[model samples]
Target: MGLEASNQGFIWVVRRNNNVNGGEEEKNEWLPHEFGKRMEGKGLIIRGWAPQVLILDHEAIGAFVIHCGWNSTLEGVSCGVPMVTWPVFAEQFFNEKLVIEILKIGVSVGAKECNRVVERIVKREDIKEAIRKVMVGEGALEIRNRAKKIKELATMAFEVDGSSYCNMQSLIHELISYNA
Candidate 1:
């Protein structure tokens, strides 16, 4: 599956180090061997545990194929990178619902039978289409711009007169007066 997916020009960045016994070491060894052959001359970067990957920091990473984890969802939203949701289990379905229905920041795979480990393989065409939809389609640029505005607001909230900064100052003043 990895080989086939790689051949289709999609890099597979798997998160195999989360809460599983010896999973990190195993994935570190296996992932390179499994996906390395196809990586020659191709722009493929693999890592065992890079939480920031979902944050859309890489310019080349035009889209995210995620499992709908809440942290991952927020990171993606904060970064203004669009998503291609592939919910694996648990509340991921709900997260997908929010991304597609509420936020309109992404598209869901829409696979039924959420309990099964069906893999929910996505083809190359689907990936390309989703990338195009998020990066080039109508309203995509508007959504990205809105996300950028929100990110700027979050940054500003930590400045001297910002909401978080003022709250912290108030708390410190209260503590000092109490001590006095």
Candidate 2:
């Protein structure tokens, strides 16, 4: 239902890192193969892990479809990119809550179970609508601005006298005093 309706004026770019194993691999492999075939040429379907994909950070990537993993969320947030969260397991559900409810950056597809044989799933139309809803709406600009502010704050935190820097210095001094 969702996949079929998801793609319209948007391309679904998919990637999977090698670190995930077990049944997750079985599930992940099937999606890229199946969905990639459908989206090939029309969109992009990348397999394996590549840091260069972060370069998508600069392009006109209107939204991200992610698992709500913390690192992935941070990267997307750093890029000021919105997301369509589909949390698989672990703390991902909490992360999804933050992205959707707290950050107000994106949407969730709800807790829908999908199968391997399911064709025409999460298709072009749905993706197009989701993209439109995220990219063209009223709160998108505000969300983007807030994300940019967080990014700046993160940068500032590492500079001299910043909270993070001062904390590190305090830790070092404590260590030295203990050693003395």
Candidate 3:
């Protein structure tokens, strides 16, 4: 509903796991009736695997709605995309803090506790608000600038003489020496 109200083009990736309910039919019951028809050109829902990194790297992408897992957080940072963080479990809340408070590149959707998807629901209005906060108005520009700066630094870290590259080399050398 929030996505619909936001009036933004989105690509949503859905993964199916055996642990979700009992079967495929049951799992799909979560989606609203005629969701695809209603969304039409506004959204694309990709079932199973999607090339997440490739999708994130695309230029048209504005803000990422993320679960605040470490990998997804890093992907969003590297892609230089501001985020709407919705943390659910484990260290996700801490990751959300890092993105929202520490990095200043994200806004939280106020997801606090971990529970069943239905129980921990963030309201559509709140979701829309967070996304709007990150993607609209002058504040959006600032967040995008911060995200761009972070992306620049993240890109530099992978260069030949960059900090990350050097650290990786050192680790490999130490491992080889220890094994020898």
Candidate 4:
């Protein structure tokens, strides 16, 4: 959805799933090359692996399209970027619920049960629909608002005197006492 419309004004840097189509060779070359030839400007940046900090730290990013993996779910939450959830396997479905139902900062892009041996292809239309709801329609604003609030909380939790910081201090103090 984002890439197809990149030339229209949006700029996107997409990390193509390494195991796209469940083990097929990475198609990372095709997207940017194709878009580069098709579009006049630098509108898309597609790669096999993502630059996590580059994406998360960029202020221009408003939303994230994610597979709802545990690490990525937390990354999005910590960054306060609203997400479009698309889970594949393992506990990803549970993570999706946390992002969509519990956090209320992300929206789901429906997926059926995944087969490890089979390749599942999501239609571009479906991708567009989910993105549309998140980027423009429905509860987009609310999702963004919640994400911002969570970002503040995430920042506080990691800063000095915050919950995580205090917990770490307590643990360190206990360990030092034992050594003494």
Top candidate by TM-score: 3
lDDT of 2 by residue, 36-70 (tens): 56655556544555563365376667677777889
> Best lDDT goes to which candidate?
3
Write candidate 3's Cα lDDT for 1-180 as tens digits: 887777788998888656556665425667788888999888998888898889999999999999999999999999999999999888999999999888999998899998554477789998888888998956999999999999999999989999999999999999999988
CA RMSD for every model?
5.2, 5.9, 2.3, 4.6
Looking at model 4, the pairs that clash are none
Whole-model Cα lDDT of every candidate shown, in order? 0.66, 0.66, 0.89, 0.75
Q: Please give, for residues 1-180, the per-residue lDDT of candidate 4 as tens digits.
A: 443642233444555563645764655554535665665464445545667656765787767878888888889888888888889887888898998888898767677667364588666677677777777867888988999999899899989999999999999999999999
Task: Mark the 10 consecutive residues where model 3 has the least summed lDDT.
Answer: 18-27
Quality of model 2 by C-alpha lDDT: 0.66
lDDT of 3 at 153: 96
CA-RMSD of model 4? 4.6
Off by over 4 Å in 4: 1-36, 39-42, 115-118, 174-180
Query: In terms of TM-score, how similar is model 3 to the real structure?
Result: 0.91
- Identify the runs in model 3 with alpha carbons over 4 angstroms from their true place: 17-27, 116-118
Top-down TM-score ranking? 3, 4, 2, 1
Which candidate, 3 or 4, has the higher TM-score? 3
Query: Model 3 lDDT vs. the true structure?
Result: 0.89
